[model samples]
Target chain A: EPEVTQTPSHQVTQMGQEVILRCVPISNHLYFYWYRQILGQKVEFLVSFYNNEISEKSEIFDDQFSVERPDGSNFTLKIRSTKLEDSAMYFCASSKDSNQPQHFGDGTRLSIL
Target chain B: AQRVTQPEKLLSVFKGAPVELKCNYSYSGSPELFWYVQYSRQRLQLLLRHISRESIKGFTADLNKGETSFHLKKPFAQEEDSAMYYCAVLGPGTYKYIFGTGTRLKVLA
Candidate 1:
């Protein structure tokens, strides 16, 4: 079965640095999303992307965060300056279309010092 | 806002024993309910959804409108069934999915 794939299973970064997480969603998926889970916390929605633009975002997706579908297959999330609290497991998911069931990747574990 | 609750953080049962992983949701509107599972060292994957109404791998969940519950259950446990189980709810008016803290089910062999 086709599944969402994320790059760099784990990442180590320093405070004030920049990091870009990458994901290649299922080829036919139209809706993409980013969710973060802090250790021992609930999974929080960050943003949703459709038609190559942001469809919706939560308060957590502030100025420092940006997403781009630079190509047909890749969806990327960039954080301008990482904060210590920004460290968490960032998951990328995609659904065939809006309101459809989403498929999630294993998740990229990020740690900031 | 909506929330899903899976009260038990851990549950253990021996093989061939019946199992029930409780899940409850707080949403006024009729919403979609799903049960997702993640095995150790594996990615999170869909275990089953309420809509199908068909058992998958002997696992079934009934959406109880009166009680606002969508608990996952199985007739008999198997060692392969050990994993992290999460109950999720998608509100009718919103696309954001609210997931329960999760219940880790361990089917002892």
Candidate 2:
């Protein structure tokens, strides 16, 4: 089965540094999403993308955060300046359609210190 | 606002015993509920959804609108069933899924 794939299974970066989390969503998926889970907390939605535009974004997705499908297979999330509270496991997901169930990647663990 | 709550943080069951992982939600619009499972060292994956009204791997869930619940259940527990379960809720017209804190199920042999 084709599955979403994320790069740098674990990442550690200093505060105030820029970081990019990469994901390769399942081929042929039309909708993409980004979610994050802080340690010991419920997963939280960040943003959703489709048709080369952002469909919806939570308040947590602020000016510092941006997402792009720079290429056919790669979806990247960029944080301009990292904060301590930004540490979490970031999961990328894709679905054939908006209303269908999403298939998630193994996740990229970002640690800011 | 939409939210899902998994009251139990951990649950233990013996092999061949029945098990139920409780899940509750609060949503104003029509809710789409799902149960996702993650085994150790594996990615999170969908186990079942309320819309299907069918069983997968001997597991089933009933969406009770009155109680605002969509709990997952299995008639017979197996060791392979041990994993972390998360209840998720999505509001109408959106794909942003909200997940619960999750419950870890342990099946003892």
Candidate 3:
């Protein structure tokens, strides 16, 4: 079965530095999403992308955060300046349509020092 | 606001015993609920969805409108069933999902 793939299974960066988490969604999926889970917390939605634009975003996805499908296959989340609270497991997901089941990647564990 | 509630943080059951993981949601319109399971060191995967009304891996969940619950249940728990379970609801129109805190199940041999 085709699955979403994320690069750098784990990332460690200094505070105030820029960080980019990359994901390659399922080949034919149309909708892509990003979600994060703080240790021992529920998964929180970050943003969703479709049609080459952001469709929705949460409060946590503030000015410092941005997402782009720079290429037809790569979906990347960039944080201009990292903070301690930004440390979490980031999961990327994709679906054929908005209402279809979203398949998730293994997740990238981001740690800010 | 749409939210999913999973009251129990952890549950333990012996092999061969019955198990149930509770989940409740708050939504005004008709809701779509799902159960997602994450095994150790594995990515989160969809276990079942209310719309399908089907059983997978010997587990089943029924969406109760009056109670506003979609609890996962297994007639006989197995050791492999141990994992973290999350209850989620698809936001109406928005296509976003609201997930619960999750319940960690430990099936002892």
Q: Pick the candidate with the highest lDDT.
A: 3
Task: State the displacement of the C-alpha of residue B53, model 3, in Å, after optimal TM-score superposition.
Answer: 0.8
Q: Which number leads on TM-score?
A: 3
User: What does candidate 2's lDDT look like per residue over B1-109, in tens digits?
Assistant: 5778999999999999999999999999788999999999788999999998989999999999999999999999999999999999988888799999999999999
* TM-score of model number 1: 0.97
- Interface alpha-carbon RMSD, every candidate: 1.2, 0.6, 0.6
lDDT of 1 by residue, A2-47 (tens): 9999988999999999999999999999999999989988788899
Off by over 4 Å in 1: none
- RMSD in order of candidates: 1.0, 0.8, 0.6
State the C-alpha lDDT per candidate. 0.91, 0.95, 0.96
> Each candidate's DockQ score against the native complex?
0.68, 0.91, 0.86
Candidate 3 or 2, higher TM-score: 3
Candidate 2, residue A105: Cα displacement in angstroms equals 0.2
The backbone clash count of each candidate, in order, is: 0, 0, 0
- Candidate order by DockQ, decreasing, is 2, 3, 1
TM-score of each: 0.97, 0.98, 0.99
Give model 3's clash tally.
0
